[model samples]
Target chain A: MTLELKDVSLRFGADTHIYPTSLTLDPGSFNILLGTTLAGKTTLMKLMAGLEKPTRGEVWFSGRNVTGVSVRSRNVSMVYQQFINYPNLTVYENIASPLRVARIAEAEIRKKVESLAELLKLSPMLERRPGELSGGQQQRTALARALAKDSDLVLLDEPLANLDFKLREELRDELPRLFADRDCIVVYATTEPTEALLFGGNTACLHEGRIAQFGPTGEIYRAPKDLVSAQVFSDPPINTVTVTKRGGEFRLADMAAWAAIGEFANIADGDYTLGVRPHHVSPLARGENPVGIDGKVLVAELSGSESIIHFTMHGATWVSQSHGIHPFEVGSQAKLYADMSRAMLFDKNGTRVAA
Target chain B: MNNKTINHAAWIFVLPVVALVAFNAIIPLMTVVNYSVQETFGDNTFFWAGVIWFEEVLHSSRFHDALLRQLAFTFTILAIEVPLGVAIALAMPRKGAWVSVCLVTMALPLLIPWNVVGAMWNIFALPDIGLLGRGLNALGFDYNFTRQPGDAWFTLILMDVWHWTSLVVLLAYAGLVSIPDAYYQAAKIDGAGSFAIFRFIQLPKLKRVLTIAVLLRFMDSFMIYTEPFVLTGGGPGNSTTLLSIDLVKIALGQFDLGPAAAMSLIYFLIILLLSWVFYTLMMRSEAQ
Candidate 1:
């Protein structure tokens, strides 16, 4: 089924939770709501699920307007982040509850419950209650129950957020494949940029109760419509600096200048904000037309395969993430390279002007 | 190497509580034990007796009658009050200004003194002039609590239910409110009907609170005293004479100390045993 949200907006008294936005999600591709905490992801999901009604719009599903319909009337399933399950029921019964509510035959219920339990690797603990299972196992039970419903719309609100790191990795790898063959509209919400990129479907970047951008996941990441979209799609946070364009060159406040090249040369920039991803700004020069930037090292974090250096440049803190461990001491001078060819320039109002 | 120091100094901190318990519970209980085992008359005199008092209290049909009556009253009130309280709690508004109003109204009956409740019900149910008594009489029903043992029992049970059902309502409401909203939302998305929601979600979540409510009401109703004493006075015969009232009649009215002491111990033991059984059963069910 195709789920469509048309001009939907939600407001609580004087505060707005979701602005007027339209989105249409198809069955074959996974849809993602990407945002930071309290960025209206959950509220938007609730509107789509009919858990909450929009103050101003209608929800359409498969050519029918389902606005104001109760969630129980709609074939929808949701798995919460808190690993919510019926605490008093065994895992098998918990998975069977929806089928029972649907009044499926006992034999069919047992078959579906057994197959779901086996798929979730919970067959060994089918008789155990939710209280007796580990966090991951309990969440798996919840997921199993949701899957057993076989609804046309399934909403997952950060299902792996509460699991431990290794458990999250395991479930994350299995999630996409689990929903692959099902002809359903899957809406997954997350605050992690890496997770959104890893899913690689249709992404709707939500920022401060507004859809900053929505398109194919890779396309949105590679070419954000605005600075807010870029900011919402970055993990280490995209670095930005405002500069003036005059006489075929961009001039910074510190008197450093660079000849505008490629897309930069074609834009008429009075005062524009330049955004560079952390990886694009490295301690060593690599990309074409690299520009040297000097700053005072503030913090240096080294993982096994990455070096993230935080430095102060032009009175603003900037981060440089690259491979190999580069130990830069605090309060020491450091020079980083920014690839001008890869930088994104935005207008004064935070609209992307040039790549 | 096991190296743990015994802290005798901790006893000093607990000394006050120990002394308080000793003076209030231990001393009074020892006095009862003394009375249970000995025959006492005037002038602070005592005669050493064995288990004669226990045997007498155990064998007396008067004691058996009162015990039966007490069990009947306790179970009847439980059967009526628990479900009624849960229904009232469920009907209450889950949020907004009405919640506090409902809570305060539910608490009003519990705040009244036991004897005052009894006296209020007595005046309210008087066959000659009280509102409820006259209203029932005018409605073509023959109801006089003072003259009929069945009417007395009915009034007594009605009064007790009114006085105590609020306790269960408050506890059940507390349990109902403490459940996270996500469960209900999930249940809605799962296509659960209202009854199924209650049976699987609300009822199981209420188990702990209901257990506490049942245990408290059971203990309270089983040992009820002043209300029945003031309302019925164990009167219209011995029909309304519960265990505690009968024990009081024996000890204070007829001055039979030995038998009263033995009966008191037995009553205390019954309450303890029943409460333990209830707690263990409820906790075991939770464990599964």
Candidate 2:
């Protein structure tokens, strides 16, 4: 089944329509509506879930118009970031709520709830009230409840955002596992760029109510289509700085950069910002080489197993994720080289500049 | 929180409630206890009545009539209002400007002064010239609250319902709004009918708010006098005389201070005891 949003626009009051946008999702593939807060990511999901109506367009589900349909008529379920559990219910009753409403046989409801409980390792807490459970347990119950619906589409609005670090890490894999067996479309939304990369689905970046880029996680991370796309995504934020082009070569602190970047070689010279991920930059020997740049180490943070080194080149500052414990003193000169093949470029307006 | 700070601040927070109870409630209760054992005539004259007044008040035919009438009136108001309010709250829109519009309109009845509420209903439900009475007469019905016991009873009940159902509606609506979209979303995916949604999700979630609504409405209806008094004047006979009306008649009309005070104490205890019972029952259910 395929879901399509065609020229959909949601206007708040009389003016300020979020955006006139269109997109499509294929069933059996995970879709991530990754965006910043207040970017209307949830709004788009709500539109598809039949919880709301778009001001101006049709929502086609399986080649049929489902716009303006009540949430009950449309088979859709969603889990929110707050881990929305029926506070008045025990975990067993919480998960069984949906099935009971469907009038499933009591025996089958018992079997399904128990089985799901075992899968999520919540057997011991099934009889416990949601109010008495821990955050992780509550979240697990919420996930189990959402998965129990067996809807054609499942929407999750950062269900893991409210979790603490260790719990977040533990359940990171369980999210994909929730949809592993279902022949359904799952749309997960999050503001964290690393989460999108971690989710590793068909990542769709929804920025400012529009898709900035929608593609495979690896491709989007390796080579973002545009500048805001690059910065709006990527953790430690892909380092960005302005560079001048001369003799058809881009120069930033004397680094010999490539002139062509995939499909961007035909662009003209202009004031532009160069983007590079911290992991792509490497420490090099201090030498008068034409292919490398030298800088002073501004700061270094050693976070347990790994260290993040800050290097200043000319007037711009950039970070490099160093291996092991590489301690550097302030004001000490440090030489670093950029991996030009992995570098990204953007114009003055923060739009990706074609190579 | 840390234990030391919590322990230190706990009594500080509880002190005001304790003091207010002592001054406004507990001490007055002691005076009532003292008065229940004595009798007084003019000029501070006192006699060891020793439960004579309590016996007389309890055995009084007027008190018995008022008590039975009070129970019927309160239950009638509750049975009519609770379901009616829940239906109105259910029919209310989930979200939008319309939600606010409906909420504000519901709150308007609450904003009217209690006596004015009585006056408004008095004029609205009058027999010959009143809108309802005139309208009913026009519709080919003999509706005179002043002369007919049935009319008086119906008018009193109807007027109480109009003035107070909004409280239930507001409380139930608040409970309904607080329910997260997740529960409904879950219900929707399960293909729940409206009735199932209410039974499984809405009713359970509304229990706490419903408790408060129930107790407040019961107390208000139980103590109700103004509107019924204004509309029927507790007249055509004792058909509309609730406990509060009887208490007022004995205390204010007949100048029987001792018996009235004794009845007032009983009335206050009934309200307090019923409120406590409701609160405890609701809390126990929540605990379970």
Candidate 3:
């Protein structure tokens, strides 16, 4: 559980340039690195796992400098995105291989493989080879095999990303509990925010090469520290509408709040965009507030219990979410105003202007 | 697709192959079985011999000698070739342009026709004009395969190794290339030594291909007649007269088809039974 990266960097091509300039993984907790595709998430995992060494920096495991240590010396297990199951071996044999190669006692190998198979619900198909199993079954068998290695550090490079939604959720929920007995540190990398929140022990938001933010999941999601972090937090990509102050009036497309928008009080308002989560936006009832926008409902898309309504603003779109089966037709005349207390203000350069 | 319709189409596809193989192999096989149990001195004439040739072969000094030679050659080739092929295959680059180059280079010896292989080695191993023989002689070794029985056997085994090691190399190399990087990573985590990596990962994974390589090498080595016959011509004495060479000496050279036919049947049966045993053992291991 004492894995550490002292200035670890990984370079993909011969450019001798690193993808992530510098990054560190927290030990003994599920640290999820959330980033977009090609953000070098898997590269970070590979560097940590010792499959490929970092071109520039040293990797330390258990306080020992493992810079020159080969992958066999690293004592890390990785579950790749693709199921790297041994095709020649049965589910039972695949799990038993690390033990068999280690020359463990025959009875112990059998007992361990059997119990792990049972835990993975693969007991019925233990005798079948990986080629015969379904994708989910094969993935679990692979997972079981990695678990059986009993390595202290587990680096999963989006293990559940390929599965269907139901299966992904099932495995995602079962992951923390599955490794509870071992206490092996897990570094789970995924781009999906829901998965990031699910693994919400310690989250590192990666942008380009550098970690934009590294802190507890709740703190990062709640504050976001910047516009990019806020954008990464919510779905339908956290809507932003430009808010400007002309003299004493706060104007935002045919809407003016008397006196002020409280969160917008301290910010210089020549240029500003209000960032609002879709779930937090609400339709303003007539006479409820003077600070309301007159706009046409551009598109209303209903998804189960909630509906997302896009309000056309000047040169921008403000998306408002109506909870509990509220359906609005497109092009309907609607009054839109987000609760000023719930919105965040961002200036140009896409950085949040602190209030 | 009804079962009957599906099955009828399958029989139509399989019938030609089955009939052709039966005509080529089964009819000849039945004839050999017929000859093994009886005596045939001339065309269409037979008499009950009641395992007489089998008795003669089992007791014959010549059969004993030929078998000893064949057994030595086959086992010797297997012992040297499997590990040597594996070593060369291991040294090959895992991927990229170099892999294709190395692969094609390894395939060169295999592509050379068998008789030409013998001819090349025969001239190469000759003491006067050949580079290898002259080099060895200059280095203080009196090398002569033409006159000495031991020298003939040594040259024949060496020739066989050169001619056929590529097959083993190709098979072992294919198996080696197929192993994914995950196993190596897992082995790394296990702190396995080089020998342990080879024993536990490389060897076990290469089992199926090695089985093919071993069975092929064994069968080819046992039935070897061309290269050694062309190179040694049975030998300066009797050192390199394998069962195939001896059988030909009887059947084609001496026109003793009676004993030769009996000998050929015995040789074929021995190969079939040995191949069956190897196939069974390999399949059983895989099943477990």
Q: TM-score, each model? A: 0.93, 0.84, 0.73
DockQ of 1: 0.70
Task: Compute the TM-score of each model's chain A versus the native chain A and list the values.
Answer: 0.98, 0.89, 0.87
For each prediction in turn, the share of the native Cα contacts (below 8 Å between chains A and B) that it retains comes to 0.82, 0.55, 0.37
Docking class of 1: medium
Query: Would you give me the overall lDDT of model 3?
Result: 0.79
* Lowest lDDT block of 10, candidate 3 chain B: B1-10
Candidate 3 Cα errors over 4 Å, as ranges: A1-7, A12-17, A24-27, A35-39, A49-51, A58-66, A69-153, A159-171, A178-185, A206-212, A219-355, B1-15, B27-55
Per-model DockQ: 0.70, 0.35, 0.22
The 0-to-1 C-alpha lDDT of every candidate, in the order given, reads: 0.93, 0.81, 0.79
Candidate rank order under DockQ? 1, 2, 3
Q: What does the lDDT read for residue A202 in candidate 3?
A: 76
> Judged by lDDT, which candidate is best?
1
| lDDT (Cα, tens digit) per residue for candidate 1, span B90-111 | 9999988999999999999999
Model 1 C-alpha lDDT per residue in residues A261-313, reported as the tens digit of each score: 88888888599998999999999987987889899999999999899999999
